[model samples]
Target: MSRIVVIGGTGYAGSHIAREAVSRGHEVTVISRQAPDAPLDGAQYVQGSVLDLDALGDVFDGADAVVSALSPRGDMENEVIGALRGLIKRLAGTPSRLGVVGGAGGSLVAPGGPRLFDQGFPEEYKHEAQVGIDSLELLQQTDDLEWFFIHPAEVFGPWVEGERTGRYRDGGDVLVRDADGNSTISGADFAIAVVDEIEQPKHRNDRFAVGY
Candidate 1:
């Protein structure tokens, strides 16, 4: 079993990914500022902030892979990008592969077209979307850091509460949509895609999307 560390593992997406990893028999550790409301089974939870490089380094040590499922919110909005940079710095020369949970805002609606953020994305979510975009851009510029950014569809979140079908469509920078022109996926299925990528290592040093 591979040793896996999931930053912000108690949050919605992070928690689901942690559970999926544990179910797969991988040794999983979750690091976050706050603990989950209900503890996850078969996964170890470490309460701490990602900003603490010393603590973050300790948890990341000797891990096979690290999944960053952190979202940009509140105080985290301005800090997520910096935290990611710090993570990359710490992971330099390490064997761990970094996996990031990205937002659709940075994804493309069409090939060679404007990013979703420039295509009339909601104003309230603009900041978070840009943060995701910036994070992807930063990763793209990093040299020799094994990484993959997983972007979800436009309609994905805890509020959506999509059903877990154990299935999803994978796409490149373009957004994936159903025949009816809808884009969505449950948190559970998204986690499935993530864990699959973690185990198989497809789309290395690139970005991809998953949706129903």
Candidate 2:
């Protein structure tokens, strides 16, 4: 049972990951701005924002792994990358591996081709996509820290509510799609992929995608 800390454990992706980790018998701690209306069983919920360096450091200390599922919104619109930098600094020389929930915007639409964001993605989501892109670029520049970024398919979220098949596919930067040329995965199954990676430590210091 490894000690795991999820930075935005109450959010859509974060909450699912937290639940999956708890179900796996890991010591799970979720740090969020506000408590969840209904919390997960056998998980500790800590009320705090990711922007709080001191609080984040406290929660990150002594953990086997840290999953950063933070998303950009409102006041945090431009602060995601900065917060990640701070988190990386805090984890310096620690044994904890950082796992980031990345966006498809930074992923390649085709093998060795242009990124999804470069292909003129929807303007409404451009801001968030760019943040993810920047986060990946920043991670690439860092050295000596163990980190892994997991990018889900183009169609994945709470709205999608995909069913968990307990089976999914993993890939590199190239986006994974089905035979019909569709890319999607359920939140539950995506959580499964993440927890599997956390336990097995595949794709270390690298990025990968999950889809079905």
Candidate 3:
């Protein structure tokens, strides 16, 4: 079984990922500043902050894959880039693959043109979106790191939390939309794609988009 480590695992997206990984028989470790309110059956929850470089840097040594699901909000607003840069340094040259769960703001609404963040994205979320955009740029330039980033559908978050259907589509480098032009994916189903990538190793050194 793969040894998967998920940073920010107690959070909405991270917890779903950790749950899926555990269900797949992988040895899963969840890292967050606080323990989960209700931990998963087969996952191990570790209390720690991603900002704790010295401590967090040591958690991924033997992991098969490390997924980062950190959100750029609250006290972490405008600070996720630093944590990600730290992870890039710490994970470079390691056997583990690094996976980043990015926001849809960085995804192209239509390929080869303006990004979603540039297309009149909500100002309230601009700061968080900027971090995601910057993080994708940072990952693209890291030639030494075995990294893959996943941008979830546009209408994602707890407010619209959907159910798992064990299904999703991957739109590489662009946003995935339905016939109605709606881009959305259930968190559980999105987690399936994340864990599937971890187990199967597709999209190496690149990013992929996920949606229904």
TM-score of 3: 0.97
TM per candidate comes to 0.97, 0.97, 0.97
lDDT preference between candidates 2 and 3, better one: 3
Per-residue lDDT over 1-212 for candidate 3, one digit per residue giving the tens place of the 0 to 100 score: 99999999988899999999888899998999986779899988778887886875567879999999999888888679999998888888889899999999989988795788889999988888888889989999998879899999999989999999999999998899999999999999999999999888889999999998
Where model 2 places Cα greater than 4 Å from the true spot, the runs are none
Score each candidate by Cα lDDT: 0.90, 0.89, 0.90
The clash count of every prediction, one per candidate, is 0, 0, 0
lDDT of 3 at 139: 95
Which residue pairs does candidate 2 place in steric collision?
none
Backbone clashes in model 3? 0
What is the lDDT for 196 in model 2? 95
Residue 74's lDDT in candidate 1: 72
